[model samples]
Target: MTSLILLSGWGCDARIWRPLAPHWPHGLEVKAPDWPGYAGRPSLADPTSLTDLADAMAEDLPADAVWVGWSLGGLLAGALLDHLPAPRALVLLGIGEHFVHPQGVSDTALADFQRALRRSPDIAREHFLRRQLAGEPDPTGSRRALRELLGTALPAPFATLDAGLEHLAHLDIHHCLSAASCPVQRIAGADDPLLAPEVIARADQRIENAGHCPMLSQPQRLATRLASVATAPDAKRPESTS
Candidate 1:
């Protein structure tokens, strides 16, 4: 049987994908892989780099599987494609070739976000909910679910946040596009304020009406797309650019 692996983004847990799991096509086993430090796992003194995290996850994923990743998870999935034993395809959601950090937004912006995380997690949580899930028409339930998932995890270290932000600024998967032999489908919200439309256009982009968290904002739609991809014979692999 084919397997589907869901990779959640930073500060997010598997619960983020819960709404979309059951809707996947039958006969496809689904597993949501939680980030090491983001799902009540023990804190690492030193945070793992995106590559390291992907390498570690590759060890556990099925030899032949489809990877569905969101945000940071999408970046990691792209980074690990070459190493995965039998990664047949990838479905990226709410992520891009690189993360957005405006020119004027100094590194302090990340530091400030981290400080807020330390001092008043609730406030930080609220801001994150507002930014990530706010665009949803009915954000209340999604917000509540996010809060509960976040509560299960320990606060990500300021250093982790800093490293993530730095990596985000520099991440460019364009170079690896040629290396990905399998299909790659990217889905982003039409109104995602964080990632520009051009970024999605750079990949096999699919625009959704939902916000950054389409899994919550439009689970059925997202699920339907996944089902189609999983069952399609062609699977729509990326064309060789070389």
Candidate 2:
């Protein structure tokens, strides 16, 4: 069975992926582990260091597993390609080469949001959670659904959240995606409000009527698409550019 690891995005823990469990394909080994400083996990000495993040997570993230990372998690996953034995495949979901795209969230807007987080974590989190659902067919319904799904989990520590935003602000992974030793696939929400349209168009596949949080808005479809990738024949690693 292919081992599938689901890595959650900013402000979220492992529980964010729970809604997809019932609809998950059988016979595949799946695991969703919390990032450091999430779900009561200890924060790293330097949460902003990709190398530190990789080292802390290496044991739990086997190289053979098909790694699926969403948003900030996807950026971290791409960085791991440089430090760890490459996963069989890496799937980047709901993100683009640049997190702060001109058409998406501008640098100023992102900075303001970061400042808001420092000032008030709860209010910032709630605002972000609702904003994520804007591209869904029924944003209000998706909001209610996500609130229920994520209600049980405590928010990630302020340091972790801030560190993630730092990554978003500075990290650009176009090189990582192109130079990956393993196959790199991209999945996007058809109407993701936070991503530039070109980013969505570049996706290997997309889930319709969904936005940033497809796991909550279109779990079954997302599950089936993921299973297809997990079962497909592994691709040969391309030659290194370095």
Candidate 3:
């Protein structure tokens, strides 16, 4: 039987995937892996490189498993695909080769983000929800769900936040995707301002109208797509062919 591992983005806890769990297909064991230095969970110190983080996360995963990751998690998933045993398939949500603004942001924006992280988590959470839901059709409920999830975790440390920002700033996973042998499905929200269609066009499968947090914005749709990918015979193709 295939297993499904859900990886959440930065500043989020496993609760972000709660809505999509129940809808997963039968016979598939689904689990959400928590990131280090968040949710009051134990985390590594002085980690370097996204691949290192991927290795740490892989320690708890089955030898071969399907991984579904969003935002920053998607980048980690891509890195994991580079070194770990091949998964049956991979699903990337709300991100492409990079999660941060590729052209790079102005000092003002960077400072603002740093300030937001340092001064008030509530402020940071609110700003994050706004951006995450920027183009979604029904952002009202989604924002509420995000807030509820945020309420569950402690404020992330500045070190973790800084490391995550650095990772996003330097992230470039297109090569990783291009080298992945397993089938990859890219899911995005039609209104998502973060990842554009052209960015995710490289995916073998694409789904629209689901924002960065599709599990919350469109749980049923995400579950359906994930189930199909898991059961499909061609889900595990070689990187050269995929």
List candidate 3 stretches off by more than 4 Å: 101-112, 118-122, 152-155, 200-206, 233-242
Candidate 1 segments exceeding 4 Å error: 42-45, 101-122, 148-162, 200-207, 233-242
- Per-residue lDDT of model 3, residues 1-242, tens digit only: 67778888877877888887678777877888788776776666764455666667777555477788888888778777777875777877777767655332334565577677678765775676677776665788888887776673444666776677666656777778788777777766655666655655545555566656677778888888777766662553324422
- Please identify which of the two predictions, 1 or 2, would achieve the higher lDDT against the true structure: 2
Q: Give the range of the ten consecutive residues with the poorest summed lDDT in model 2.
A: 233-242
Candidates ranked by TM-score? 2, 3, 1
Candidate 1, backbone clash total: 1
Best-fitting candidate, scored by TM-score? 2
**Which candidate tops lDDT?**
2
CA error at residue 61 for candidate 2, angstroms: 1.4
Model 2 TM: 0.94
For candidate 1, give the lDDT of residue 41: 53
Worst 10 residues of 3 by lDDT: 233-242
Taking the tens digit of each residue's C-alpha lDDT, what string does model 2 give over 32-147?
98899988898999999888988899987898889999998898888888888988888888987669988888899899999999998888888888888899888898888877
C-alpha local distance difference test of each model: 0.67, 0.85, 0.69
Candidate 1 per-residue lDDT, tens place, 1-242, comes to 55778887766667778888667777777888676665555444556465566555655566577788788778767777655654767877777655654532235665676677678665675676667776666678767766665564434555564455455555666555556777778777766656665755654556566778778778888888776666662455555543
Work out the TM-score per prediction.
0.80, 0.94, 0.84
Error (Å) of candidate 1 at residue 22 is 3.3
